[model samples]
Target: MNSALQKSSSIFRTAAMQVRHTSVTRYIGTPPQVRISTAEKCAHIAVIVGTILAGPAWVLVHLQDYKK
Candidate 1:
């Protein structure tokens, strides 16, 4: 019974190793081209920056109310 358990454990480990090695899909080619107009690029950046700043700005504006 001990030998049987050891054999099954070894088989499970071997299968897991093979699956781990073979399952990965690698990308070797150049990335696909993407085009964005200047206006659109500016708008995207503005949205991201505004979102990051809005949280802190809101907290600062409400600081007096929070102290109550």
Candidate 2:
């Protein structure tokens, strides 16, 4: 029974060590490259426009409530 417990604990420890090493290796690996293409730029502009439009749209939609 004691040897069985030791073997299970050893396996668990080994798995944990492997996970740690794999995570560390992944972090150390080359990161994905980024390309700032025209499409990406357009998408960013759309996001910014949407974000900016949301505020004014919200204000316009709720403008009547503020008058009271």
Error of 1 at 53 (Å): 0.6
Runs of candidate 1 with Cα error greater than 4 angstroms are 1-32
Clashing pairs for model 1 are none
Give each model's whole-structure lDDT: 0.91, 0.92
Q: After superposition, how far is residue 51 of candidate 1 from its true place, in Å?
A: 0.6
Q: All candidates' TM-scores?
A: 0.52, 0.41
Alpha-carbon RMSD, candidate 2: 5.7
Q: Write the per-residue lDDT of candidate 1 for residues 1-68, one digit (tens) a residue.
A: 99999999999999998988777645446765887789999999999999999999999999999999
Candidate 2 clash pair list: none
